[model samples]
Target: MNDEEQYSVWPHGTPVPAGWRSTGFSGDETTCLAHIDEVWTDLRPRGLREWLATRS
Candidate 1:
């Protein structure tokens, strides 16, 4: 993402946190929500939701 892009926690040049990451260069203009969700899940494998899912 360029400096003009908006992010909640990812500030300008903030390296992606742990597994919650992106190269910040999804230039294809496609909404990467699912991709992002995957990364978020990876970052919180022990998270409640992910833990419950793994049990299913």
Candidate 2:
């Protein structure tokens, strides 16, 4: 769930893979969309890439 009232750019419904980020957009809407694209560029699905990589 969205933790804040601000613009939340997290993938909903569909299962988001790991390494993906949940940016806290401040309700800018336009900027949020752009941010999403930027985030997507660097983000990869779970076990696909290392963004916030963790070792088990």
Candidate 3:
């Protein structure tokens, strides 16, 4: 996920693009999605700061 909490899934062993870091967990599709749901509590596409600004 980015600073904005937006994420994309690339094929295993593919090179990650710039400005992204691995969450360090890898598995089949079901496992990966469960991990995301556990960790990614905020589903907003905007960064926390940006989202808060909009709410205000």
Give the lDDT of residue 33 in candidate 2.
80
Question: What is candidate 3's lDDT per residue for 3-53, written digit by digit as tens?
Answer: 577666667998888877777788988888888888877677676668689
Clashing pairs in 3: none
Estimated TM-score for each candidate: 0.25, 0.33, 0.67
Give the RMSD in angstroms, all C-alphas superposed, for model 1. Answer: 8.8
Q: Find the candidate with the highest lDDT and give its number.
A: 3
Which should have the higher TM-score, number 1 or number 2?
Answer: 2
Candidate 3 weakest lDDT stretch, 10 residues? 1-10
lDDT, candidate 1, 1-56, per-residue tens? 22222222454455665545445535222345544554554343355556689899
lDDT score, residue 16, model 2?
39
In candidate 3, residue 54 scores what lDDT?
Answer: 86
Q: Give the clash count for model 3.
A: 0
7-41 in candidate 2: lDDT tens per residue?
A: 23543454534544444344455776876566555
What ranges in model 3 sit over 4 Å off? 46-56
lDDT of all predictions: 0.45, 0.46, 0.76
